[model samples]
Target: MTDIDLNQILTFVKVVDSGSFTKAAEQLKQPKSRISRRLAALEKALGTQLIYRTTRQMQLTETGKDYYQRCAPLIQDLENANNAMTSHSVELSGVLRLTAPEDYAKMILAPLLEEFLKKHPKIKIELVLSGAYLDLVKESIDVAIRIGTLKDASMKSKRLSSISSIVVASPGFLEKNPAITKPEHLEQVPCLNFNVGQKNRWRLVKDKQDIRIKANGSVEANSPELLYHFALYGRGASLIPEFLCRDALQSGKLVHILKGWTSGAIPVHLLTPAQKDIPAKTKAFMEFASARL
Candidate 1:
């Protein structure tokens, strides 16, 4: 091909991602006819069909899939390079895509974003709230605020904060049961478990020694808030993040148990794919979350 058309390829990629000429045009802010013509020109240049068009939708052919996988990263890298050059500006611009857990997104991040948007009106952020671990490279996400520890060696991680899990129970429940003085005594109490692991097993440590105890409980939940509610109603003892239960503990709604022992410290991480030129938007948002959270 004569000086392979980069713009045409970008337009084609946008069309493929959007799955419609009109949608691509809206995203690219171009005319629909222009997008159609660009895709046609790209196909002619490659001398093979890239997309299989249908009345209702569009699908990528085998060659198109390969090309997309190759070009998407290149296009993103170029955009990142361009963004990096302007990253030091006082005013933030462009899109910032972030991913984090559901509770953090709701209880912590949503309020922060509300204040952030008020300060910087030019930036647009797309927040994906999920419980599963996400691949930043495959999804083209700018940053991820992860809760646990980081195991991936390919990414740059900054420890935002350390969260320690606190075991709590209602006054009435504790009144019925004896005070928890040792780790083994927990077996006698009704324990509310989160999504950490099996119902009966809890990993804890004391005096530089690790201990695993089999906990018994009637209430099991996937959410910390639900467990908090259950503990409030005298259902069972629950281990939850200190940030979530600090207020409740102060108000005497929940009583902290085993004050001398600790469950573990969960490191909150801010992860980003190793890129040469991180965008200003991403950097600004990362700094904001780091400063606030």
Candidate 2:
């Protein structure tokens, strides 16, 4: 009798799953004769029949069922162990690519990332910041920090929080329009929008109704940093994130407007591609940022 090999056991499992010797042979990239020969050898070596085969079906024997249940998890564990060891070597000390929106990158993620770098000194992080949605697989990014709504179904996500949006203006700008009290009053005042050359429309919800208002500011920019500086110079009222202007509102450089109406909150999420198992480095970063962000 021939000795049973590990490859034979794996091939047996595949053949059982595929339910046809020809199909299993095709999947394993081998000839049907060789596949049948291997299974016969495996059964001979074990001194018992594993599978009872028919023309249209293949069913496991009692011994085969018990053996498979015992061996499948062991095979999976061995594969996982191999992958973990190899990934730690290929992944731990290499660069991890990430992406995010500019405002979140500059104001929220940068400082937190700096601290993370200090902790994992060997791993390098490269960040791509943009307002448009980035393709995680096409860009080969390990992860992305995104705000607003996440509509992509192909990726996995862990939500950080729902950040509040506030209507803010420079104290001097608010001084010029002192009659503002409710949400609809925004239509009468000079408003700022950050769409650059695009249409300057602002949407907010109050008392279960959605309202859209067109902005009428003298300045516009694609960059939130530029818009922030413009708001500081008393250009006009800009709708901005509460977290971004938290210090300014506290310091009285900017004042809150439309206190009764709000654009609601946007969710922050950490997204990654749909992989079989997440890598150790990606898992580490996710755990760190999930708590910190």
Candidate 3:
């Protein structure tokens, strides 16, 4: 019956995403009343109810859910196209949300962000350092630096680095514990574990032969940084990425064991949403990280 406006659609999406008119208003930098009025206008213009209000929480009606499922992609596409087209001249501005494991964040990403921010002075960044696999679409992440094989088949990825796992232990631990002459010797000493495939297994490869060992340890955690610390403290030997332990291995904090064998090269990736054109901020960060990593 009437033409729907982009502002109304954006406002509705913001409200749904933020979970309340008050919160959405804060994100939009608009008054709560203005946000409510826009959402009300959208419903009136459509001639149907889109949401049910309970005075505390907002729930989308069936129509609203269906509408959001369709409109969100369209809205994202519009913004992405505009960003891609204008990015040539517009000095990248806006908050870039990123996620990565804590070890990478501390050892690699933090410094990169520092240099990137200096060059792109107008851009802001939000970094989430975690080992959890977060949904890019649901979490509104701009891009993520992830290790290992990419799981989300829909997301586009760029290879940032190829890192091989190195077996290591503290010098003190090696002195006190039995010498590791072969892969199976790892079972006798505690093995600080990293989460892989719901089990603790290190598959070492050398000269086309593979040795599989079920890692046993007192300290097992998802974070490579934590495991590195554990090894540094002589808690156990751990199979960690060479990139993560290279500095320590050289500085004598951690000793590399089984030097001839490796856990193979694992590809690190930069992931972005597959549905949209690469926005300037995300593209710039990815490029900066790719070259540096």
Candidate 4:
């Protein structure tokens, strides 16, 4: 109807999507009172109550539900049109918040971020590193680089690459231990376990044959970097991502075991929140990382 009405409808859509006025305000970068007033004004202008508010929860009324269903797609289409028009002309500038595993951030993302920042001097980055999966909306994360199978169907994902695991141990440990000639030999030796809720089972494939073994290990950790270090110090053999221990393998500090048998490959993905319009800086970083990593 009016320009102010259009703005209020956008706010209403955001509140519905976010499930609360407080969260919607945070996302829209506005005060909670302002968001409340806008919604109230919208109701007065339209002569219909859209939402039933409570201290603990919010629910859309019958009218609100129908209105929201109609408005959401129209709003999304408008945003897409706006982004398409301004994308090429606008120089991307903003804080792009990202999250990833601690070890991967240190080893892989550090250099890429540096390069990306150099290219776009106006953009700033905030990186959160953790072993556990963080909720993108809850944490306000713009992008995430994750390794393994994705469980959250709500988030959008782009597969970057598949990382292969290598079973490795130090030269000294191998000298003292029994020869690990076949996949079965792994069960006899002390193996470093990457604990991720599963049992200490290592699956290897060789020449169309699949073998699974329950690896016995004295040290078990959730972090791959720790496992790599333990293997380097001659503590035990470990299954780790090839990129993490590439330098050690090259320097002869760690030796690749079970040469013919291969550990399975884990899929790496670039994750983003399921939203209609992605921020330019976040999209730019995703593109940059997808090409390089």
lDDT of each: 0.83, 0.81, 0.86, 0.89
> In candidate 2, where is summed lDDT lowest over 10 consecutive residues?
84-93
Each prediction's TM-score against the native? 0.66, 0.72, 0.69, 0.73
1 against 3, candidate with superior TM-score: 3
List the candidate 1 regions with Cα displacement exceeding 4 Å: 1-85, 88-90
Please name the candidate that would achieve the greatest TM-score relative to the true structure: 4
Instruction: Count residue pairs with overlapping backbones in model 3.
Output: 0
Rank list by TM-score: 4, 2, 3, 1
| lDDT at position 252, candidate 4 | 97
- lDDT score of residue 286 within candidate 1: 83
Clashing pairs in 3: none
Q: Give the top-scoring candidate (lDDT).
A: 4
Q: Which residue pairs clash within candidate 4?
A: none
lDDT of 3 at 56: 76
Q: How do the residues 1-293 of candidate 2 rate in per-residue lDDT, one tens digit apiece?
A: 24888878877877876778889899899998899888888998999999998877788999999878887777767767887787556636678889988888888888988888887788889989887788888989999988777889889999998876678889888777756776667778877777843378877767788887777778777776677778899888887777788888899998887775676777899999998678777877888899887
lDDT of 1 by residue, 161-227 (tens): 8777777889999999978888889888899888655466887876797888888888887777788
lDDT of 2 at 148: 74
lDDT of 3: 0.86
